[model samples]
Target: MTVQTTPAGTPMPDTMEPEDDDVKIIADIDEPWLPSILTIETGLPTMGVALGAGLLGVSVNSGRGPLVAFMIGLFSAVLVFLAVIDWKTYRLPDAIVLPLYPALGLAVAAGVAVGAITPTAALTAVISMTAVFVILWLIAFFTGGLGFGDVKLGGLLALVCGLESGYAAALGALILPMILGGLVALPLLFAGRRKHEFAFGPYMVAGALLILLLPNVLVPISRGSLFH
Candidate 1:
């Protein structure tokens, strides 16, 4: 069996969880509305940034109407920032990620307010987020294919997707990201970098965005715009 090792040739951890820092700071500060923001990369890869911008455009053009579009467009911007940070650092800070749950919760509520999403769909979003978290946590426990950051992000994605579609679609979203990740992994394996750890967050983001934007992509094709 091929053993994966780091640059120093040490066996990779069973779970590729980021090593915790030892010199932890202790403080008594007000638990303000936010957690401490972790250090993130200011410089991002151009391709990833461009893709993010494209996704933002797609979100705006999703044809879900104004209020829904604004919410998702905001989310797309946030995802872009997270995706680039994760792509560079392989870390998604709790300060950034955890806020998204409540934000999406608010989005669902607003969507209901605007009659963009049904009350039943809002309930299903809750169910879908819970189900996605449990399933992702199990996968992390077993295969270590995902990090806690990815798990949280997956739940957020599930909530948004469930609000738009339904429970089954949200659950079905689990597969595409893995398939996408595997496809990316293949090149590294072939290039003899099989042991190299790459970020999984971008793939997860891409998968969710694809599902969310598919109707927009499909409608034009169906109407024979490209074919014509």
Candidate 2:
């Protein structure tokens, strides 16, 4: 049967019109309010994390490259969102990840053009991501530190971090959560826990936030100029 394709929101043709048997009509529809609610509900937490990380980076870096750090944090937030959704729903849809590539690329290019990020710093960022993923992936494989979702998330995180502060920042982000997880899990383990599986997405989010905001948090601890 012959079929006519109609634009979304356009009126459908009358049944009397002739149709080809081989034609297939694809219908487009708008999402209802639930999607908006879900997006807001999901996006708000990620935004909060991003903002917090940005402030932290500004403080630690002495406000040298706050925008670059903020952009990195924002990109990390997308990875965090994907990981969280996958943890909850067991699927990481392309809708959450594809848009981030362009954002990261543009942010990096802009930062470099503006001298907000040095080319050397950008190279370090790449190394930082690579070291973290390779080391973590090996550990996770041998010790089950994480799963495939985390592996993919780590790689995504590397791209963002590589464009910002290099490997140290990424390490800071990755380590923050592990430390937090240990503190939290220690109590449970001591309380006679058995056969437990902790949700890791939250920690990954925390780590990224720590990396983003390290300038603020690290200043007091480091108590001096950044070395190297």
Candidate 3:
């Protein structure tokens, strides 16, 4: 049998994987339009995410400045991209998450070099990394709901958030995942589903970002009995 041709004049091979169509169509879509739509639809949340991530990073670094905040925002965007890819594939490949640890150390060192991160803050950042990693791993083991990737990712985040907010950073990191999971799960549960599987990183990112940007609200609420 002969293959069919798309309206755009591209011929579809008979044995092409089904996913190829979506990939092709997505690429064929205009590039400029994506940024435009992302800004339009996700504008507020994107900005919030960026600001939050940066603030937490700066706080841990003990360096608060527009530049640091901008870096946080940029990294937040990258985190979003990584999380989305992982959610789709269910694989948080170390190729993306691993290097971030040492790179974060460098960023912290850079902040120190520039006098953004004081010696005290730098020390805190180091301690935060170890503490968050151990804590998250324990939670993951007991619940069986979290993965090694989550624990690893949480460590990297601690350098940014834990150093910044101290104990608050840890609180935000832990509570946000449960909240996001609940938000996603409650609807499903009400519909009578008992157990379900979700990627969960996005919600963690959301909680972290919220704590970074709007801790005044999120921290209090997270500590409250919102779930009850």
Candidate 4:
């Protein structure tokens, strides 16, 4: 048996294996992958995104009309891709997220031009994105539980939700992801899984998808006494 020494010069058993949770956390921190490799390996997820986008396009048209639905479908596809990448690597690459800002801007602009959303609505979307991003950043800074990637993803989801419904939808986007992630984690906790961390991106994406599909659930609140 080999002995290992800690940085503090304490001796430890090298035969001790890391816990499953520890292995996952270590991989999250240390694993790296090339973009090309990720693209090739994520075919199933990509196909899933495509199918989701198709269904979303149909749903959006039925609910909100065809003009805005296209953009929402497109955005949903992007979110799905981002969610998969974050789940696999625990990182959000700027190569994907950065270019998306301008693309989203264009999509919003197009929506306004087509009368799918008003200029006021577009401004609200921007405000929602900024607010959600700052709130998550503050949470991460204080609690050290979330990362910048999650913050950025939250901002993007808020933007989409706000555009689709209203500020209330944005609020739902902010709250729902954490609730969904917590629900998944609860079972593991009850089973005695300690110090485990899971990806928040997928839940965030799921929340955004839910908001898009069920905007009426939030739209009523957006116009209710609480918001008004």
List per-prediction Cα lDDT, in the order shown. 0.69, 0.59, 0.66, 0.72
Instruction: Predict model 2's lDDT versus the native.
Output: 0.59
Model 1 lDDT per residue over 1-228, tens place: 233555555664444543443222233433321222233334434445646655674565567666666666666667766776687668877888898888778878888898887898889878888888899999998988789889988888888767655533353347667888989898999999967988999888777776565644533443467565
lDDT, model 3, position 34? 33
**Candidate 1 colliding pairs, count:** 0
Per-residue accuracy of model 2 over 1-228 as CA lDDT, tens digit each: 234554443433545442554334544423222243267666677567655554545455556576665675455445555555655554444565556656666777788889998888767766766677786788779988576556555655666645545544555547665776688778878887744666665666566655555544453344454553
lDDT accuracy of residue 141 in candidate 1: 87
Residue 21, candidate 1: Cα error in Å is 25
What ranking emerges by lDDT with the best candidate at the front? Answer: 4, 1, 3, 2
Write candidate 4's Cα lDDT for 125-203 as tens digits.
8888888989999998998778888887787778877775455556556777878888997898898885676778888
Q: How accurate locally is residue 57 in candidate 3, as Cα lDDT from 0 to 100?
A: 52
Q: Distance from true position, residue 217, model 3, in Å?
A: 5.9
Is candidate 2 or 4 superior in lDDT? 4
* Candidates 1 and 2 compared by lDDT, better number: 1
State how far residue 29 of model 1 sits from its true place (Å).
18
TM-score of 4: 0.72
lDDT of 1: 0.69
